[model samples]
Target: MSELAGREVRFRNTDIALMLVAVLPALGVGGYGHLMLGIEILDKGEPDFSLFGVAKTLSAIVAALGIVLVGAQLRGRNATSIPPLVLRSLSGSMLFLLATALAVILVPRSLNHFVRELQPLSVLTEVVLVGALVFLVLSVSSAWRTGLGTLMGINGSVIHALLSGAVFLILMEETSWGQHWIGFGTPEAFKGNLQNETNLHNFYTYRFELVYYSTAVLAFVLLPAFWPKRLPQMLSQLGYYVPPTWFALFALPVCGLMYESWNIIPYQIWFFCGLLTAVVIGRNDTKLRMAALIQAALLMLSQLVFLTLGHNMEDGYELSEVREFFISVLIAGYALITWRRATGEGASASST
Candidate 1:
């Protein structure tokens, strides 16, 4: 027991050390960009061959490393375990990196900016729509199998149907439902209040983004907490293969950083959703709960610090970048700890 505890401590210390190694240089580059270039690398969309560009390159590398680290940790391999899953994930990651590199090389510098701008929106639309379709299929299949009868005034199929519909709505809004694709002009009603002539999001109010993302937060993070069994059984099956950490990571980026909609509301939704996810995953475990609380506190504190300090800078930083950075680190930390605990629990269960 003492040996096991010591090993765990050593492993945790190593993980922390690696994280510091990963983050410090990135932060240094960010600070340098802020001080010299008057740009926040993590938030800027401009593609220039100046200090800003260097900062963007470095930041991207760091972000990729961070993602790889999370993938490694969530592969469920400890010191004694062979890392087949980790290797597989790493290979896929390498292929993605290779493709990105090829694109960068093949595309002209003038067109690179255009590619970068379109990539995020395209990726966001695809992910959301695909997820919605999956959920819709699962919900329909589950309802078909279980019969769409209500129990105690609550219907499982109805809840899932709502989730699917909401996600589809968000997807439509994101894509403007082929309005932009089809090259049609904005509607007259939307045109009068247009924030940006070309952008649909700016045409309407920020309320659109808020409602869509908030509904997502509620369905995926909050609703599951209130009634775990409310989720489709087919969807729940994913938990066996994909850890909650992946969802937390994916949602954190999309909720806060994906769209430039409202100020801080999207981030607040992400923050709470993360906290709720921690609570659900921790269950009745005191240590896990404590860790979750600490993570939440730290996330809030970091945001406060960023907002306070950000105003002093010339080109004020994006709050989303700050939110994303802190949440990613916190998610990685807690996910690793919870993963260890889960493995320990499983081992004990099997022994008993």
Candidate 2:
């Protein structure tokens, strides 16, 4: 549980969620998926696969460090204050943001106005800065050790959410840096981004840049307050009944739409199904464990099904490959759920 979502929502968790939710609608659309896959296959494009791809590679390093630090704390490695760790992370975050801000203001003006005129550079910048800010706050949260070590777990999820959301956005925006560009607020930004989507030579992540703004505002405000506690509790509550058998949900909205032959219906169904089922499933501690097991199993099953089916299909047709590394999470979630079910603690009420 400590390695997964925290016992409660914590800092930056909100930022990641808000960022992901905004794009999910587009990412889930069959048309969009097809378009993206086609680009990847036809254009021979790639995800950041770099050993240092900020999204995948570097995140893993931070996770390992954080996890080791967390474990050490648990096993009585608290000779140093967790607050300092949090502060260090936060301070680094602030420095990065300030430098980015300065670069946006000073650097772009030096380039030709035409470069500014045609590039979707500014909005791309927002994705990086916003993500960085979210992490900055989350890394330094005060409740890092609160709630039965739940805060650490929640912090991890918040980190995942933030990192995950950032990767998704970077994939949308063609510019890797996501720094400020010409035309900070204008129609040209949108037009430029749409144009960039077709040039498979360069990858662009977000399609509608304005959508990014609203998402940033939401994550910045609400997520930091509850990301550490809310998401885990909610998932824990969901486990009370639904069982993490979420792979059942992969085609959730997409296939739903295809079957109904109506564009909006499938997504609407997915939204409600996912939301409602999560609520109805959880009842008490014992059930939460069962739910975790099923959910973990679902992840395994989903990945297995995807690979099995994916191998047979042509490229771009496979269900999303959101995780190149999910097996570890599968094991961890299952083990924790099992441990909790075996024990009689958590959520203040008795389940047995």
Candidate 3:
């Protein structure tokens, strides 16, 4: 009984500490949002360099912290069990939503310009894509490091090369390889469709979307599901090597598609594909299977909420965006915990 009590205390302390760590980013996002709101409310439409600088600085810090925390979690063996991790991540997500609410209260029309540019969401999409790129690069590196590259065969090598090239292209286009930051001039032919002076997506219109969707379907869905015996053996082996949670990473881009088009087809495809993948790969692991199923259901619910009630909530605060953002955060958080578990198991299996 004494040992049990001590364990409970330690668990509670750990939960509190995790909550604090998660809140740091929420605070930074809220602070930046508040400053931006003030600028819009007071200065009409003019950009305030001082406030913008502060906000950018805060966002950078938050991004850095997020990366560091995720890295630590990946490398360390100190994570709580799944139930606790889920609860803590959900709590952290709620806190993040609360911070967004505070920012909304500070300035009602804070998201107006942001909505026009589809900012933050756009940024989030880029970040996810970049993350996928990193994952693929690391996977390729791991395959080579383990001498699994020799076993990949010609078909597998071709697929790997294709995926690598595609990911690199997408990442470059998303960031414009720092061209946006450096204020590179847009071409005369491309000026009309620009989202802003910096972004080319408004002009391009779904060019990369097709690329991403097709590649995702090919690499993650079709090959694994249909070609399981022949060409995709190496790909399937690759999937087994990585965390099962990685399978859900494709959902991010699909969600972005839903947000942009407000179409239910993307959501349908997302749900079905997620269900299929879960059923196919999670034959052995109940936890991973359940995680995939839950992710799909939650994603569907988010879409339903956004479609049914989002417009009604868009009076001043852009509650729709806020809701969608929080939902995405929750999904990502859930995925991270599951990924850790899956990878940890994989590591243990490999060692044995």
Best by TM-score: 3
Model 3 residue pairs with clashes: none
RMSD of each: 14.2, 20.1, 18.1
lDDT of 2 at 250: 20
lDDT tens string, model 2, 1-352? 2343233433355445544554444334434435653322112222333332223223323332332232222221011122243334333323432332233334423322312322433333334444443433343332232322233345433443454465444433434333223324324334464344332223343222223322322222112111222244445432321112222222121111111111222222322332222222221123233332343334333333332233333332111211101211222222233233223232222111
Candidate with better lDDT, 1 vs 3 = 3
Worst 10 residues of 1 by lDDT: 343-352
- Show model 1 residue runs off by greater than 4 Å: 1-117, 148-159, 195-204, 222-283, 286-352
Clashing pairs in 1: none
Q: Write down the lDDT of every candidate, Cα atoms only.
A: 0.39, 0.29, 0.40
Candidate 3, lDDT over the whole model = 0.40
Q: Give the Cα error of residue 249 in candidate 2, in Å.
A: 34
Pick by TM-score: 1 or 2, better one: 1
Quantify how close model 3 is to the true structure by its C-alpha RMSD in Å.
18.1
Residue 56 local lDDT, model 1? 45
Model 3 over residues 248-270: C-alpha lDDT tens digits?
32332233213223321222333
Error of 2 at 12 (Å): 24
